[model samples]
Target: MRLSMRARWALMFGGLFLLAGTALLLINYVLVNEIVPQAGLFVSNFAGGPGVSGGATVTAPPPVLDKQFFQKGVEGAVDTFRASAMQKLLIASGIALVVTGVLAALLGWWTAGRALRPLNTITSTAQRLGAESLDRRINLDGPQDELKELADTFDGMLDRLAAAFDGQRRFVANASHELRTPLAVQRTLIEVAMADPTATPELLRLGQHLLHTNERSERLIEGLLVLARSDQGLVSRVPVRLDEIVDAVLRSSAAMATEQGVTLASDLEPRVVMGDSVLLERLVTNLVHNAINYNEDGGSVLIRVGDRPALLVSNTGPEVPASAVPALFEPFRRLNRERTASRDGAGLGLSIVRSVTHAHHGIVYANPNHGGGLWIAVDLPLLERTMTSLSPRPGADPAISRG
Candidate 1:
């Protein structure tokens, strides 16, 4: 099993303590029973009266060597001492182990924290960092250890990422501007040709087709530019009334809905959010347009604004496949059958909505309606009430009404 660093350190310290204590206990056992007794006998023999040697007259009689008595006496005393010493050794070893184990645990915890401090910093930095905050760095200051090396590598990677994103934003912005000039020239030339007094019927038909094609190209470029700008993140925020944006979108799309034979319905409540007004308007417009374009004839679109979520757009249309719903937010992705039926869209409507919502730190959800159609809702952060002016309260009308 894999163990965390803290656990590993605790085990290591505990094991070392156990091993060292065992070794000391065994050494004490040997010294008390064997070495001390032998040393005492040698000392006693030297302290006794002198013994007769080499036929010389002995000044004092040598002590009798009573083998059995001496053996019994020494053996009895040694046994008593051995038992007492063994008991003391056991008690001391037990006390030492208990004390050392607790000390080892505390020491291990402190050491582990010291060793993993760098990793904690790295984790916090990564969590706080994103595409918008890539400039923040973990300039770790310490010895040139392994952790320091890892921190350095992470900072270098962030540097590369920030540079790459900057390059992409510049390219998109420049390319969009560059392409607009030629497109404008082409449009002017086509208009001049069509306005000519000598224009033929066949030439007029061709000019109309070219004009439509150029307009589609212009919309595609505009969508790309919006996507790029949204990816750069919002730099400023202001309180924008979501209901006002919804009413504006409804006004603009009323003609399109009428021409397409689709009924429009809405129940918008006054809800204020913090975001860019232009982007929020675009977000609402794209969603309303998509609901109308993909809808069936005589179908209905329902828009709702609430204090909680801010905005929701749902439409009645051909049955949408559950699996294909997620791909609706991807750029240039469209259902082949749906695109073939509706020639006006460039498949960037929902994608732009998603990007703009994300830039404002909001969330968008899409769900396929049971029988047919799609339901999309946007949840945006609300502006604080302190900054909002008070208005007369209206009764809660969560019900959708069609006009």
Candidate 2:
């Protein structure tokens, strides 16, 4: 039902070519009909009969009567000759036109292919373009035309995009140091004040609260920086054991889980995925942290790694509405929660998870649990080498949930 650009172009060119040929063929036929004499053009038809006119048993040639009869005969014979000649001419011309029209169509197809060659190059380049490879350009070289203008415009847009990302990357790179130092200093000051021997109970309580606030601020800033970095995409990729990363994240997250009165469990399979190890760890860490922090006391967090996708994290918490599940992956949506009442999140955990997963060309899916809480699954691409070498007992669990 739908035609590709190349096919459409070829068809258009062929149709126009056929139309011109048809017009020329008709014009030639018409001209021949108009220029030729309709009567008395052929003298051969009026030649004298052999011997003399005969009758009865022998057939005889037509006998001329007066001048009017002779003129009428000549006109009739000439008309017959003209009609025969024109019919032959029309048949021959029609055959030639058909043959040439086919050739013209073939030529149009080839020409269309050649004309669209640059578009193929642009398409392939765009398909491979990534945040890390934004310096690429079509750089089509030819006479100034629409396609040339299009490529140049795309290149210019990429240039501007590359510059803007570079600026954001610079800010994220420096932010880890510049932004965190002050928060660290504030935390240290608060701790020192609370440790003072002469401090009253009231003062110590105030200092302790200040310290908690400072730590929360630090977390918020750190999450923002990670989110920003991940958005720029991975700078490089290497094979990393996703199971191992989950294990490490759980170990680090155990204390937080205990503090929140939540239990941590895992079912890790030996699965390898391609991505930056650091970013992958951050992705797992965020998933685990969110699982623990959002749940009620005595709730449990379960993490699993298997074939297809590298990771899945699930936890029991307050019942999440099915309609409101999409907001979990959104950054700063947690801000609304904090504004109303204090929570242990800066609202960037799942945002980081989604961002890092996308940077690695992976997907995140999430849904509300039947009982309560959420079921989040991350489907990351596995290397063929790893998949064939040590295939997991099998699962590319559907996009059930994301943090």
Candidate 3:
């Protein structure tokens, strides 16, 4: 049978007391048998003369060792020694067993409690940590022991959970908003066309409007899918030139700029980075498109790329509130001033930019431009090889240029 820790400790200490008590009793028995008889013989030898009479000397020499008296004296001495030794041993054993047993029990309980305290905290915290109560954390204010490490790990898990839940909430809200826009437009167009059946031109216009709305819906869904894939870390990535991506975005944004009467310019320097080229291109394109779409008439858009690789796209537009800047990269957050603009987007542009930048281990922020517009800055680490290729060589395009 197996014994519990406490029981084992008690038995160990009790056995040690028993062994010590037995040894002491045995020592007492031997000492009493040898010493008592020798002392009796010495006393008798000193009391009796060297030539005492036979009867007196022989019969009363020493009562302890006399053959006639030997049995009785030895028996009495042994009995007395046994009684005393047994009594002392019993008392000592009882005291030692009680003291040691209590001490061992207390020690075992204390040690076990100390070892399992963190586990208890973990269990309690886990029980409380569900979908509604993810913010609860374990108390780690103890020594830097294994339990503290365990608490730290638990805190990390809670952090991850909180981030994941926040992401999920944002995603759902954004998807709903994006989906609602096209559905609302389609419904309005259908109602108008039905109300004016006499005008074929209106009907045709409404059909075109519905088609465009459907296309927009499709695009939003596709964007959501891409964002979901990116969140899942499923996108294939490879090394692509950062400058190439900027050039591509600038070319794409030029047509939009011409339509808006806004000039789009870029100063892109050659630099390489590791990422999915297609996504990076799309990310840059979205930023440029957003900047140009929201710019004022006759406004200018600037794009810059170089070491400490950055893309600053600023345009002349109405100022955004300083407090609202932090939420600009959050999905579905639209500026108050732009709420009335017909070109207000689905509000996922900056979110996509942030997500893509995060995937590449980069940061993007928005700040007020000096000329009364917003500046979106994307800063990413430059790859080692990109630094080596920075020097201008003969017959090569200048290291930096604006086009």
Candidate 4:
């Protein structure tokens, strides 16, 4: 049968008291029965000796007197001794049993609480955890002890679970929104083409529209797959120069900027970091694409890389509201003001950039630019080898020195 913690403790302490108290009472009974009677007989014999009684008692008193008196005296003495011993044993045993039982009960209760504290914490934390508070954790102290180790392990599991759930939610939301956009466009074009049967040009336009929608859907699917793989830790990583990556992104984005009538400029410096080159390239590409797509015609975009292994992409555009910046990194969340006629995206660009940056142990943040644009910053730690080689040494290689 399953017993509660308190019940188990009570049973344990009660059993111990029973065993101990029974043993003590038995020892007291043995001593009273044998030793008390023998000692009483010896005392009676000594007191009934010759010349010990008064003249009224006559010579040595009668033998009957001695026998009867000794017998009576011994009987009374033994009775009194037994009574006293029994009284003392009862009092002492009662106190001892009470004290022992109370102490044991208290100690048991305390120990039980200490033992189950981790489980209690786990229960409480689990109860409080939900979609909005997945990052909450149990306050386990250290890993050296057993319960603490278990709590830490549980917290780690929660961390992974929360990440998995969040990723899944983002994937579903982004996929639905991306799919919805192209399908809506295709439906609208089809209706227009059907209604205007005499317009051959309109039919051709609708055909082109379907092709574009298909292409967009395909790209969205590809991006979704890339994000899923990154979340699954499938991306390969290696040391790559951040400067070179920035240069490549700049070159690629420059053509797009020209087509959009936006100017692209870069102020990149030499910096190395360790990460997946393809994912990092995608990260930068998404940021630049977002900047260009959201910018006004003749807008300017600036890219910067620094020794701290930071990348900043700022474009001249309408400023996003402060309240909306936090949601910008979330999938399928677009700022109402930035939803212009020229902008076209599945709204997964920033989400992808944020996820990839997180996988690389980096942070990306978006804020309003000083003038009238949005600024996105990617900050990562420099490569270990690069940092080590940068440390100053006497007569070091001039080529390796910081420019």
Q: Which residue pairs clash within candidate 3?
A: none
Worst lDDT run of 10 residues, candidate 3, spans: 51-60
Predicted structure 4: lDDT: 0.72
Better of 1 and 3 by lDDT: 1
* C-alpha lDDT of candidate 2 relative to the true structure: 0.80
- The candidate, 1 or 4, that scores higher on lDDT is 1
- lDDT per residue for candidate 4 within 1-403, as digits (tens), equals 8998766876787678767877887787676555544444444544566432211221333565566666667567657866887788778877887778787777877887777777788889998765445778997875578888888888999889888877876776687678768767876766676567586876777666666666666566667756764554423467776667767787777788899899787776666777788888888889888889888899888777775548988888786777779898887677773442223666678888888887777888888876567989999876655444542323311221111
Task: Answer with 1 or 4, whichever has the higher TM-score.
Answer: 1
Could you tell me how far off, in angstroms, the CA of residue 265 lies in candidate 3 after the best superposition? Answer: 1.0
Ranking by lDDT: 1, 2, 4, 3
Between which residue pairs do clashes occur in model 4? none
Weakest 10 consecutive residues of candidate 2 by summed lDDT: 51-60
Clashes of each: 0, 6, 0, 0
Better of 1 and 3 by TM-score: 1
TM-score versus the correct structure, for each prediction: 0.73, 0.78, 0.50, 0.50
Which candidate ranks first by lDDT, i.e. highest? 1
